[model samples]
Target: MRQMSVRRKRRDRPAEDAAGPQVPDLATKGGRLAILDDTEMARIHEVSVTLLAEFGMSDAPPIVAELVCAAGGRMTEEQRLTFPPDLVARALAGLRRDVALCGRLPEHDMALGDGAVHVGSGGAAPMILNIDSDTYRETTLGDLYDAARLVDALPHVQFFARSVVARDMDTDSLLDINTCYAALAGTTKHVFVSAAFPEHVADIAKMCHIVAGGREAFAARPFLSLNINHVAPPMRFSPDAAEVLVAAARAGLPCMVNTFGQMGASSPVTVAGCLAQSNAETLAGMIVAWLANPDVHAVYGARPMVTDLRSGGMAGGSGEQALLTAAATQLARFLGLPNSTIAGATDSKIPDAQAGYEKALSITMAAHAGANLITQTAGMQAGLMGASMEAYVIDNDMLGAIRRSLAPVEISLDTLCATMIAKTIRSDGHFLGHPQTFDRMKSDFLYPGLADRRSIADWQASGARDIRVQAKELATEILAGHFPQTLAPAVDATLRETFDIRLPVARMTKP
Candidate 1:
């Protein structure tokens, strides 16, 4: 009678308080979310091709114009360079799909063109959330290096792109050189840096060769890549970045031709219109890179940004942004090209609850859509205007959970455990003492380094700190102790002498 009363009490609880039925256990699958069907994708492609052939892109460098004309492209009466459908097809066919983003260490190498997903850090924010003060300040060279070290220590962050601009640099050349050097010094994983001038590309490549042992060795692996914002909004090329693209491609460095168009501002207001324009611009950039060096490794980076129509401000954390990026990933898959896109950039000023939900929603969508490289997944804040060290630690935990959700579940005979279940029923009711349970515990489960899973009483006993406090403590520890020896002492001295490397050696070592 007492048991029956307890059951009735549980059943009569408020719907919100009562636990719902358990979710069905199922195998994980990806690339299933479809915002556009085949016919819609076909229409978008048709529109993109039409935009390229008719409207074309303006402000092409003379060399680019010459190369495109030589390859069946033409200059419009309005001086815009236009690509015929056949020419675009040829360029797409000539794209090198088997590109490898090699890290300094072999275990960190990642092959592109597969549908597998990778998340990493990326941005050029001039400011950083100071770890000590919890206030924003101009990012210095040390800040960039510290961010790189944090990324190196975090397993979920796959690559280290230049996350913050060194505001202390005196010149663009120094900024470019030091940015790449700092990233290389802080992590052995893949590094991506931007060149401010076309001539700077060779100097940066020279530094890479010094670290890589020789020119030939660097060329063989090429752990560093160049990020060139070749296109400026709706069907136009930035002449300087275009020149940098040419230089980087000719220097035998992998180039990610990034085109960011802000919808309702730099691009069309509608999502499809934004995608069409961005796709055309990305194709034009790739064609130019292909012309510069037929064997150049190029990644198709089509990033269509979102804008809040009400205030005309960048809305990177919006649900619309997630949809646009996922659709862009699908388009890249459709073209059979190695591609990348931006996601997980929250507009929040701090890494709060808002940041958490915004990042998870966008990143999950992009990962499921099979974006080969999803940048801006960690440490970014304030609409990509700030980098947060604590956020990297926190986001690492989030990324791990998301990755676990994407892992496949085993359903074979052994995994089914019918015999073990029968034996357990015949003996004890639970499998706590079973050998298989012991064997599978570590293999099948992922324990977060930061997330607290303790019971309520235990959590309170342990001081009940929030995630932010825990993350700050972890970030502080990593920044203080985890300086990677990416270059030998001799190599480091050689680079310091070769370029105006401004990061102090003392900062890179533990005292």
Candidate 2:
């Protein structure tokens, strides 16, 4: 027994499927939405516990420098490091602050900390997906198996991040165990592997031991999680990748730290020295998840992007990724953790006008700076290292206009109508649909696809082909008509013979 628990059958809500594409929760405005306070979240947990007791991590990985010298931590020089902010506030007081993501048929699962805006894609970067055709810059593996079958058939992609980087005749652990068995044989969601070490977290712990059956039945049922990457400061993290993130946080699953500090290089150039070395490399990977399991689950991730050096590349604009996404989402929701930070990435590779004014100020200050889990929403470009199907259909219209301007306002007093404005000021014409304009028009109408509210002879006889040719014909009609969420023919023949999946037989041209 003792198997279930994928955080007890994941779901915060919305998976119903009367034919997909519903997604629009953004953590309820008509309900609550608006956190981060406690004196600015205890001043972002006392500046990430004074940057891990005065500057700790860097280059670590001799089994995470032998568990930062068996937890007492102190090395400096030779894979440089240091720790003990009481072992990162005892890994933020025994972690696990909510971690959902399940749906092998529980109504198609989809939900990540409710406050909506999940969309993910791109990690490990080889990007440049067949943009403008003729294999423009060739990044293949059939473009990460058609971007993991169009991000498991996008319902605004809730999770996915082994985003695309395939070039290994085996770069140490058979390329994330054959790119996580070809992105779980083309997406059923949940992916972010990047486990580049700890023997690729034992090949993502042996593809969760051939899908939940070993290593304590895949650690009481954790499908796959290891987006690890905390090597900031000319490179940190290597005590053998913090002892394989303390062996996948003592097998409870979760190591998504991802620290990116490059304002002037190795963090702290400004933007509060790169959100204080990405909040001390995500609380020193939550102090190796409180020395590998105080109750594991430490994501507090980051992306930090920007190394422009006057156009050397990597400045997905919007005033430098909207001030590094409102100071790393106000220092990761003032250290309450679990907010990987985002805002429709755009180094502008076609969806021009600096890709719609740098993707509407980093996806509207990453939804009013109260992030939970939002990565480079849809295909990126040039500075973020290009990936445009027309910037993923103008980032699904920049995530339906920053989720309808973070919704919220629905006050009463009959919403200030004052008796329909005193009988429409004696009928001098007023409201457009009056039930308060049909209750604020679907929370402020946001209908866009290829922008440009036409006029010039109705956009030159309609179909004046722009918005990057209708986002490259909607990425060739979603890579030839979509179809996500698959894998079930006896779990696709035990994941195509535990990852051997043929396709290399091009030898007999003897015809």
Candidate 3:
């Protein structure tokens, strides 16, 4: 048995110096909810191990099968590669827990597997709600860049995962290269992108290396990671995606092996059954990556989606979806792996009241359940088929509130406030004018930037604009003004000369 030391570093917050009380670090305030007890979690793990040991996964890539076989996995008569319980256990134990998803800037970096939660944009939606026209259209490479910029500007959205697919690209290689380029150009924060083919992974890595100044620097703090869907659900490995996983592991890139199994369709109808199968599949991915390179940073992405039996479509906003995602987070934690799950993907077509409640319920539940990374927390809509810019702006405010909800109650003498209460009673008879009240205002409270909190009369006087309209205005303002200079001029020139970068430079800068 190989001994692996767990790296459990918490997310670093801005230091509090002479500068007034620092804003509380919301990422550190999760893991407060556990839907499954120890016995239930153990039972789920048992089922998953049994599934891998008996049922096994089919269609494993040649390299994956070879590596697994070398690591004690067996090829059955049915041509499925089965992992023994002991091999699965060893793989789980060998996984490096402290995986840092580094950003271009140090402050934007996120430390995973340390019991903290981070929410960011997700989905490779084919369509986007045009900010200028308020209509859904096929997403282009420019839309992907603009969406990344929106996420970069939004304070609450911590990372950028290529939200919309660039549908205008003619070829798979072009799509893969441009998608990665646009994301890197738009945000200095950590980025996640998918590779269409195994060969494209090297080109994307080369692009990242140029952005990071060299190969060694990029490897030390990789600003980009791959979100590989290695499994096709129903106990089968996607050949191309599995090959991409192998390539990513060898390249030393952080990879999130996402296994999205839709219940009642690709997986069993029951939640527990879906979880067990998804867990088995996710473990299989990790085992492959581990065998490829045990030092590779791999995040367990067990995203089990919900299916509405009546409509036979995805129910991304359903309460059942929230429960399943939260339960998956628990399962990941039980195995002590850095994990991510999908939430806030409302089935609503727009960012209306329905979108609000659906996104809030699912996102909040996942956060409380302590998912290390919660994707699709911003900009996803129409059951993850569309990305909305205005929705991203509105979801920022909602995520801020959710993060604040996770903040621990400070019970210090100052917070206890017996002295202040007595002083207020003896003096102004209210704490409204108190110094503590004024001092804690900025530090303790997180005021929404876009949410209208004014009086009804004031709102009416100001034209009584709804949240969607306000969000559109704000998003438009951000898109117009906030063009981040993530890449240096020299690096940009070199990249353009090297790869088929589609996003125009004029669009990345303000005119």
Which is better, 1 or 3, measured by lDDT?
A: 3
Candidate 1 — which pairs collide? none
- What 10-residue stretch in candidate 1 is worst by lDDT? 1-10
Q: Poorest 10 consecutive residues of model 2 by lDDT? A: 1-10
Model 1 C-alpha lDDT per residue in residues 310-375, reported as the tens digit of each score:
988888899999999999988888888889999988999899999999999999998888788889
CA shift at 354, candidate 2, in angstroms? 25
Best by TM-score: 3
lDDT of 2 by residue, 347-373 (tens): 656567776777777766766665666
RMSD in angstroms, candidate 1?
Answer: 8.5
lDDT of 2 at 443: 41
Each prediction's number of clashing residue pairs:
0, 23, 0
- Which stretches of model 2 miss by more than 4 angstroms? 1-69, 72-89, 93-121, 134-227, 230-240, 243-284, 289-299, 302-335, 341-373, 380-386, 410-415, 425-460, 464-511
All candidates: TM-score: 0.92, 0.34, 0.94
lDDT of 1 at 281: 94
TM-score-best of 1 and 2: 1
